[model samples]
Target: MNAEHGTPASAEPGTLRPGGRTARVRAAVLDAAGDALAEQGFAHLDLADVARRAEVGRTTVYRRWGTVTGLVADLLTDMAESSLPRSETGSLLGDLTANARLVQRTLADPRQGALFRAVIAAATCEPRTAEALHRFYDVRVREWAPCVRQAVDRGEAPAGTDAHEVIRAVSAPLYYRLLTTAEPLDPAAADRAAAATAAATRAGAYVRPSPAP
Candidate 1:
């Protein structure tokens, strides 16, 4: 898309504008970066190369992102913000199933899967990249934490279950499949994850709430 298409007009310094010409430019650059990272890997992700692919000037890319790590960090933040909110299905199994399905769907998508693989590979060699990846997971995990908490309130899971950890457990295997095995991230995988997580919660894997003291 052209810079004028979705670029934001008033982004703070060193950040992509929220919406307008700058936003469009940022999206294009991010798309180009995803392509380059997937095709060539992080070692080959040159700002100039991304600029050329995005049809933007080198100065604009540099002025906004400053460094490769910075760009990746911003991309992660944007993705987290843009991702769908957690589902409130009112049951531990249902919520976890929803969460698992979302994870499977995202990792199975062509562009998103490739983008994650690129970032994962980059993380192995760069501390900053690894940190950014962790931050991305943190955002996603936090987003779904309440579902676990709600399950506890409903007595579906033991009170005091660490909501964050429960949520993480649901996606851990899915990510493992994405990063390691060539197995398809199908609904079966999602069902397995949901089942495992629900079973664990029922078993009191989550901490129980403290009794009145």
Candidate 2:
């Protein structure tokens, strides 16, 4: 695996002017790559074109990202890290509602929505891209897992509920609406997902099963 693919610095354009020319060049290349990916999709992402767009050399782009998958992996990591922290609203319903709203708002944004759709389409045919996409979700799920655990402590949910899975479930419908249904990712859909998932969790839908003898 390429180090740049996993390194946070490669995900976005760096602002540190002290790292000198090399850092600036790397940042420029990465930013250009991101724009290319967002605009053209992975199939049309050309390193030479990215270099031209960034006014950087092709050798620099290749030397840093190595391949399209590597670039995409770094981009996903960047996106995950840059995302807002999970809301702590002191209750499971409130927290889940916050989560759903955040997801709905993000998926409904024009630029981000298009970028996600393109990335998702790319992941369908690229195993590495799929792994990166999974990693993005894992980070998000972990971010909100504590909320579920807190709900359990507060007696809002069963003690054995899988917090991560519960958090994941809250967003599944929103993503389904975005990818499958042509329905708008609006506040109504967000509220429905949050309410449904919260109700299911309270009903023990996410509780772990008892071990079989």
Model 2 spans > 4 angstroms off: 1-27
Query: Which candidate gets the maximum TM-score versus the true structure?
Result: 1
lDDT values for all models:
0.84, 0.84
- Could you tell me which 10 consecutive residues in candidate 2 have the lowest summed lDDT? 10-19
The TM-score values for the models, in the order shown, are: 0.87, 0.86
For model 2, residues 1-213, the per-residue Cα lDDT tens digits are 335333455443222232567667766776777788778888998878988998987776776666878777777877887799999999999999999999999999887787788889999999988988999989999988999999999999998999988999999999888999887899999999999999999999999999999
Residue pairs with backbone overlap in model 2: none
TM-score for candidate 1, residues paired by index: 0.87
Q: Write one digit per residue (lDDT tens) for candidate 1, span 77-146.
A: 7777789999998799999999999999999998888888888898998998898789889999999999
